[model samples]
Target: MSFANCGLPYHIGGDIKDRSKLLLQTPESFLARFNVDVRVMNEVVSINRADKTVTIKNLIDGSKYTESYDFLLLSPGAAPFIPAIAGIDNPLTHSLRNIPDMDRIIQTIQTNKPKHATVVGGGFIGLEMMEHSTNLV
Candidate 1:
């Protein structure tokens, strides 16, 4: 279930050459291998412990339905800590968190071809971003 390869951009030299190599498993493969139901683009809205049911909402369509579950495990992934800074929302500024974030960063780097990139944080992700930016330059 781990889709976020946070360090992938750095490993692949900013541009992902082959996406199939990064894909750990497809939904069909996951289902066949683990025998677990996989529902994408769905959000868990609420859980009713009294009735042992949970409400799930479809992200694409504004539809909600309830399903009974004997046990539930929640894994809310971490998001990038975007500080409130000037021009942080600008199209030139970018942050890498997931695959899409990395893609956007790569696209911006290729399209804009900036002379320099200023990474805010000094954490692992930030360092990776710095490395990628340097390589791009």
Candidate 2:
């Protein structure tokens, strides 16, 4: 999960040659290598402790399903801690999350050519983003 944060910062810095390299295992490989089911583009919406089932929504389509598991590992990974602000949803603000956020920030930097950028957060990812953006300068 920590490596996920590591992935985006490097992409932001243009350190990683290819975006696919960030993945340790492809969805198919993860399923094949381990006897685990890898469901790509599935959004886990809720977990029912009483029923011992996890509700998942397919991100691609609007289909929803449930999975019953004897044991479950909640490893969604840490998301960029974006605090709620009045205008935070405005077009300009962006936080480095998954590939899309990294891509959007990079495109914004290249297209807009902003002189100064402010990255808020004192966490590891924030520090990494600072180091990455400095190289871009």
Candidate 3:
């Protein structure tokens, strides 16, 4: 999902009402605009520099294919850090990183309707989640 990651909290806080606004571009739109084939659910398992080919796995079908490319760019983003604390694996504990995470948080908030929330990290995402969560509660 190519979206404005920074605006996740605002969206959850009801500041950004339209969820479509958070999406920067769709794969089809990106391909149409830039003529670049953006594969979303494909994972590059391995790269062969000698052959200039990459072995990609289809996440949906579990099928593997090799594609040759002139240039390969890697931009694996960060993962939410879960501290090694007791009850850290609880379902209520959420980390805001991607759209799915944000959705889960919203669903949890709506379903559980907890009165209080404990935000862990003090980073941009964390602070935004805290602010939005407060507004939500």
Which candidate wins on TM-score?
3
Query: What is the Cα root-mean-square deviation between model 1 and the actual structure?
Result: 2.0
Tens digits of per-residue lDDT for model 3, 1-137: 49998888998899999988998988899989999888999999999999999999999999999999899888887788788999989999888888898899889989999999988889887777777877887
State, as a TM-score between 0 and 1, how close model 3 is to the true structure: 0.92
Span of 10 residues, lowest total lDDT, candidate 1 = 6-15
Superposing every Cα of model 3 onto the true structure, what RMSD results? 1.4
The model with the greatest lDDT is 3
TM-score of each: 0.87, 0.77, 0.92
For candidate 2, the 10 contiguous residues with the lowest summed lDDT are 1-10
The digit string of per-residue lDDT tens for model 1 on 1-137 reads 44648556654364656655565766788899999788888889999999999999999997999999898888877887899988788988876667777677767877887898787999887777667766777
Model 2, runs deviating above 4 Å: 1-3, 46-51, 84-87
Give stretches of model 1 more than 4 Å off.
Answer: 1-4, 11-16
